[model samples]
Target: MATSVDKMSTDTQAESIYFLNAGAAQAEQDRLNRQHRLFDDMMQNDLLPPHVASALSALKTPPKILEVATGTAVWLTEVAKTLPLDAEFVGLDYDTTKFPSSLPPNITLRQADMFKPFSGDLLGKFDVVNVRLIIFALKEGQGTDLLLTSVEPPSQAWFRFQDINWRFAKKVGRDMNLPLSMVAYIKEAGCVDCDDKAYPGNSQLYTRGREDWISRTNVHVKALAEQSLRGITSLGGVEGMTTQKEVDELLACFDKEFEDRIVHYLFVRAWGRKPEAD
Candidate 1:
């Protein structure tokens, strides 16, 4: 019966963080919602892990779920559909502009910075806390940025994009490799049964039985590339990519690489359970 984020303020704190792909444009929000669906499909349409889902269902009271950096609340809203009607869903983010005006009756959206502690009432309250694709929000030394890796052979154009993305991330101080370290961070936080699963982008045409994943990956990559370029150019641009013409030319090359089946990246999901009170 406790509220999700009772005392947390609802003011935007956009300037407090450095996010390379940050945007509140409708196009950006649409891209994020599309990416959310792609990720849900990649995980086989399950919002939470099997065990977690089972635990939440078995709870006697209405379960509390919190999603950090929840853009558009697409994932949370979808998860809400599968749970009890009274189950509570809370979404926290620094920017409220992207938050949807209409959410499920059981859901609440709040403005909060992840770097800061939540109000005392929120501590030890959530039945599940979900954070995804938060690499852009981290600061230097908080995480590392590494080049993309794939099982398939990369094309020259793919490599070029990798180099560009690396340089752009460096210039903007965004961490791209934090996903690789999430399980370690979870274990360090004293969470039990920590584990992670990796989903490959699988843009390879020869990968049978994954046609859907291939299509989704390609679409997600293209949209993300465009969004990143928009963000970069808005920042007065990164080296070798300071103009709209340059961004377009690079995107064309990236499209060719995707069409030729020459690009892929691993997406990892890590989770752990907090120790219960004795």
Candidate 2:
């Protein structure tokens, strides 16, 4: 399908001022794919929550799914493998450059900004929609919203890095507490049974027998920090991080901390159902 470009809304430019570089490079794609795996594992490997699965099963025809801000389209492609062959999937992102060259026959990836209203053809066109990790690009009122480091104690690095990120986020007018606001957004959108759940990304690091989980979590998080360095530095660097050298040094410290410590955070999922047509 062809990509669609809508006319710019007055707030469009502000909404599009993402803190990270939206480039499509092999390394970024690899990191995103691995990140998806890590998050999927954290969520107990269920592509859809039980209730969502039940809802889809009730449909008379094969269900259609949409994933927003679908960088690399990894999740859509993975979930497609679990569903019936005829079930359709669509993935949308502001930048389609990172979408994989190959996809399941049932999947289509398109370029479109989520902050803008979707085209008429895409409106109300799917049975289910998925959005993940789009918080960094959101503004204060938007329903969606990370950082870490190692010099000093790992805890210090973790919280300090978060502080710097919060400052940067405030400067850019983006909300840092996306999970807290999601249910409200859902309710405002007139959806029913709105709720959110948080998944801990501990990867079993604190569990004695889960050394493999620890190793994988460490590797995944470090890749996250490495990928974020350029984007953070590009925004003129946060306080105490005004130069690329400073950010690099901090990242090295974070790497050391990740190597020695059990680092984890929360991944939240929110959902609501639109009332059936009268």
User: lDDT of all predictions, in order shown?
Assistant: 0.72, 0.73
Best by TM-score: 2
Writing each residue's lDDT as its tens digit, candidate 2 over 1-278 gives 13224333223433464645433368788888888887787888877877898878788999899999998998898888878999999998876557889887899887777876887888887999898887778777775226422322345556656777777788778876676678888899999998888787774555563677766767776666666656666666677877778878878877767764565577778889888889
- Candidate 1 lDDT, tens digit per residue, 1-278? 12334223223233433433445557778888888876665566778888899999999999999998887888899999999998999998766667887987899987778878886867888999998877766755565322655524466655666676677667767656588888888898889999998776543344464666566666766777777776667666667878889889988976776652434566788999888888
Q: List the residue pairs that clash in candidate 1.
A: none
Question: TM-score, each model?
Answer: 0.82, 0.87
Pull out the clashing pairs in model 2.
135-145
Off by over 4 Å in 2: 1-15, 22-24, 144-153, 206-209
C-alpha RMSD by candidate, in order: 4.7, 3.6
